[model samples]
Target chain A: MDEQTALGLIGDRLAAAGDDCAVVDGQVITTDMLHERTDFPAGTTRYTAGWRAVGASLSDVAAMGATATAAVAVYAAPEFDGTELGAFLDGATAVCDAVGAEYVGGDLDGHDEFTVATTALGETDDPVRRSGAEPGDALCVTGSLGRTAAAIRLFDRGDIEAANELFRFTPRVAAGRALSPYASAMLDSSDGLARSVHQLVGASDCGAALTGPLPIDERVDEVAEDDADRRELGVFFGEDFELVCAIPEAELGPARDVTHCRLHRVGTVTESGVTHDGDPLPDRGYSH
Target chain B: MDEQTALGLIGDRLAAAGDDCAVVDGQVITTDMLHERTDFPAGTTRYTAGWRAVGASLSDVAAMGATATAAVAVYAAPEFDGTELGAFLDGATAVCDAVGAEYVGGDLDGHDEFTVATTALGETDDPVRRSGAEPGDALCVTGSLGRTAAAIRLFDRGDIEAANELFRFTPRVAAGRALSPYASAMLDSSDGLARSVHQLVGASDCGAALTGPLPIDERVDEVAEDDADRRELGVFFGEDFELVCAIPEAELGPARDVTHCRLHRVGTVTESGVTHDGDPLPDRGYSH
Candidate 1:
């Protein structure tokens, strides 16, 4: 089965499954799966892998506007090296500590390749969902984009330290909480801005129009071939782990004042058709 | 690092990391990882794989004496077959239905070999822990043992139907709940009866002595060469998914009355040393 078909099947069977995090009795939960070949580059450290893998699930919790409580991971590898395992746990713990959550221990198993599956738990009385955007809501995003794009370039150039630093972007838990009260709809931009906007509007039965410049990370220019390449990286390449949300225009100022991260109003939710500067935007981004 | 050393490291780092399921507030959560090479034999169907993989985590929730609420799985395969994927989800949903929990949807990815990582969530006011066992407690088990052992033998002889049926054992969630008020310490017998007893004692600073005959499943007689072989299968071979618990002798009768499954008194918690029929039982069973 293709990914879309499989997802459709899942949606058919599980009513509470398609959201970024499933809410049960005011507790939010999400899981992510990452493998060595797909998620980790040749020069990536196990520590970065651990951080990035667990962070993916944490990002989901943030999208729901919940207070992250703890996370657990099932780590599978061909062999267990003391140093590597310690470093991985250190990274996992460090990321959890970064957000004031706990990195609870999980199961271990041996496999032919390294794989990590992580689940994060959080709490909230009211979780923001992807289906709440209004036609006139302002589309906004937290932080600059293209961090992973820049990290991949640095990794390709053998700059492991720089790449690792870029790979460890913070999950937007605080920003999500700050915007929870006013935001009409919310989701993490792990699937790239374009795809995220598409998904947000898709869920809300709305469209979006981008009128402002894309929030490209400054570092992306260092590796980009041209302005178009930089824009592509910013709009299409994902793993930024930023929040993409829609808020009522009247409430955007209050939302901005409360958010800890840089919040930018990039577009407006529309009644029909996604567009960027009068041109239709393609619904494409990182998947699987 | 070896498994023991790694577990010790985890224990040192996270205070809430070593239990069968970590409890946050009143919620209990656990995760498990399984790989094609290590977990699935040649004749194993995707349906059984789905049931067993998710069942493992559900069993952990049961061990904590929690009411399982939901489960999710990350399913990775070299290629997704529509029929196979449907069967897998069907089995997952079926197992959750069996336990009165929801099998919420999970992520999907591609890998060289099939792999699954699952997480189960539950709720309980008074959660049981492996560290609560005490001397003079009665050691008891739910249902019969050696089911997986007999299943493996059947699979070796190409009895795929019977093997799959055996692989789909109950998670013992109800029994765990019934024993919660009385069981001092409880865990599922996935690690084999002998290793489970050793773990129960090790966690609670107690020992055990098996005075009665092992609860060997009658099906074991079909594959065993003699009574000794049947006993070994019941004692050492794992994956039975039955509850092995320590209950105060005074409360054992009440626990037995409430439990829906067949309960049997197998041994007694002692001051020191694990023994069976006046002989020291070796501390060994399934690992990884």
Candidate 2:
């Protein structure tokens, strides 16, 4: 079974499983699994691994427009090196501190490959759902795209420091909280911009038209072969951990004013059929 | 670094990292990691693996005397077998239902081995801790021990069905809640009775003397080589998932009246030194 099929199975049994975070008693909880083979690149440090893995779950809490409270991670590796373990905890702590959350301690175990599973908890009274977008809602995104794409390229080129730095993208917790009151729907763009749009539109039973130019990160120019590659990096490559939200056109100004992060008006929710520049937008992006 | 060293490092950075479950704003949270090689034996069903793994974290919540609210797991395996995945979810859901908690769902990823990391969230206004035991407090235990030890032996003897049944020991969530009002300190005996007693005593700055007969499960007779082996299995082998608590002598009656599980007055807290039946009780048990 694949992730979608697995999710379907889970959803059949659990009514609260499909959302970015499972909200219980006004608390948003989310978990993520990242393995060495699938997540950490060849040159990645344990610290970067720690930050990226924990931040991924924090982003889910952010997606719910919640106030992140604390996070814990289960770290598993074949053996534990004191320096590496300390660095990993340092990174996890740094990320939690950066997002105004606490990094509580977690369990450690032995495994053949290094793996980290993280859970983030947050509190919220009114959570923005993915199913609330209206026909005239303005589609927006926070932060530029293609940071992870550029990071991967830099890693391939042996630029370990820059790659790790790029991997440490900020989770959009503040942006999500700012947009919660005004936005009709919100979700993290960890699954890439195109797929995020598809998910938001599908959940709302609506469509979207991307009329504005994609906010491609400048770093993409350093790695892309051409404009097409740059576009692919921005639109298809994920791990940006940015927020893609749908705000009423009338509320967009206030939402933008409240958010400290860069906010881009990327498109507009439509009555039907997703498109960009008059062309169909395929539902495709990162999986795992 | 070992688990202890890693934990010490984490403790230096995260003040709330050393407790059974991190309590924040009247909520309790915990995470646990289990691997295929170290956790599951040959012939162990995916369902049993799911139950034991998720239940481990739930046990932590119980230790905190919290009402379990919800749980999520991160499942990673080389391939996602539909049958295995379905059975795992079934077991996870069943365990949560048994404890009045929701198995809200989790994430899936591909890894070289079958591994699971679970997180359970709970709530309680007056959370229990390991540092509340005092001199003259009664050291009590809920349920019997040696269940997992016998199960492992039975599994080795090719009794898969019986072994799985034994492995499905109930987490003492209700009992913990009942004792929370009166007990001085409490924690699940996942690390075995000896280690648990030592931990409780160490945390509370006291000692204990176990005078009553060890509540060894009857099934151990079928597997143990002799009385000595039975005693070892009962006291040293862990994974009982029972509760070892310290309660004032005056409150023992009320605690027993409220808890539905079998309650045993195994010992009394002392000013210093740990012993069992006039012999020194070594501080040792399951490590991972």
Candidate 3:
């Protein structure tokens, strides 16, 4: 079965399962796994792999507006080069440091291929959830999109340096925290803007009218073929790691001021179904 | 690098990494990953694999004298049969219910082979640690040992029923919690009794002189050829999922009363090295 089907089988066994992070008594817990062959390209370094793996889970915690605290990992491989493993640890530590979390110890095991499962712990008194959005709430997003899609294209074309630079991401922990008090609903867009909006609407039992322009990263213009490609990449490509939130229009100025990151007004929450440019936005995005 | 060396590289990143579970702010967190090739033999069922995987992490939490709260998983496979995935989820849920922990969501992805990583969260007010053992403390263990080793042999010999029965285990959550207030140090023997003692000593800055007979399970006598085979299996075979602890000699009776499990008085903590039968015990056990 696919992930979505498997998840359906799991069905409400855990109330925290659908949220970005499972908050238990104020502790925010999130986990993400990365497989070498699927998650990394041939040119991807072990350091970058480690960094990206840890960052992915931390981003989930950020989506809950939690303060990153500590993380543990399960690292599996057939055998690791000492230098490479060290570099991987260094990369993990660097990302944790960037988000004000500690890279705690993890388990190591032997496997035929490389895999990493990282779990991050965080804390928050007032956490955000995607189920709280109401009709008339403004749809907003933090930072830009399409950089990761652009990076993948570069990697495919053998532009390893540029790809590496673009692939590395900063988890929006600080900005998520800053927007928590005002956000009606929030989540991170690891599954592209289109999919993320669909998930948000599903959770909140509401809809969105995405009438504004896509938040296209300048990097997309440099790497993509044309305006159509840029728009498609911005809307459909995943791994953005940016917070998408529903908030009252009045809170927009404070969110921008507190986050110190450009807050784009993407749309407005409606009674039902998501639309962009007067057409239905598809509910598909990257999986696995 | 192998698992041990990679762990050595991790070295002192967190005070609790060396312990069975890391306790942060009264919350206990632990993770374990199982690869298909290394963890399961041919003919193993998907249900057993899932149960074993989730049980492994819960075992770590139990070793810390924590009450398991919830668990999350990272399941990866090249492709999954719908029936097999359902069975796996059933197994995972069964184990979680057995331990009174919620099977809260997980991440699923495609990979070259089947692998599972489980993380369990728990809570404890007075969690046990491996660094608290002191010289003159009594070294003790819960339940019998050598079952996993015996099970491996059974599987090798094509006795699948017997092997499955022997391989399944119950995490000592209640017993661990009962013993928490008294244990000087504690850890689970997932790496065999001998290696576990050595690790406890290494962490506590002391040694143990193992002077008693090995706690060989009754199944070992039924499965093994001789006394030497029993001893070797008990000491060398791992994945026992039993807790080992050090407590003051005077408190042994109270610990036994509290845990309600067979409290085996295997030895005493010393200034340095382990010995059995008046000879040095080898510092050898399962790795990876």
Error of 1 at A191 (Å): 1.4
DockQ, candidate no. 3: 0.63
Ranking by lDDT: 2, 1, 3
lDDT of 1 at B111: 85
Tell me how far the alpha carbon of residue B107 in candidate 2 is from the true structure, in angstroms, after superposition: 1.3
Question: Ranking by DockQ, best first?
Answer: 2, 1, 3
Q: What's the i-RMS of each model?
A: 1.2, 1.2, 2.0
What tens-digit string does per-residue lDDT give for candidate 2 at A179-241?
899989989998899999998998899999998689999999989999999999999988899
Instruction: Please report, as a residue range, the 10-residue window in candidate 1 chain B with the lowest summed lDDT.
Output: B2-11
Alpha-carbon shift of residue B73 in model 2 (angstroms): 1.1
What is candidate 2's lDDT per residue for B1-288, written digit by digit as tens? 777667667766777877789888888899998887878888889899889888999999999999999999988888888899989998898899989999988888877888899999999999999999999999999999999999999999999999999998678899989999999999989889998999899889999999968888999888999999998899999889999999999999999999998999999999989999989999989877
lDDT of 1 by residue, B215-286 (tens): 889999999989888988889988788989999999998999999989999999999999998899988787
Ranking by TM-score: 1, 2, 3
Collision pairs in model 2: none
For model 3 the local lDDT of residue A82 reads: 81
Best by lDDT: 2
Candidate 1: pairs in clash: none
Worst 10 residues of 2 chain A by lDDT: A3-12
Q: Could you tell which candidate, 2 or 3, scores higher by DockQ?
A: 2
For candidate 1, the TM-score is 0.97
Give the DockQ of candidate 1.
0.74
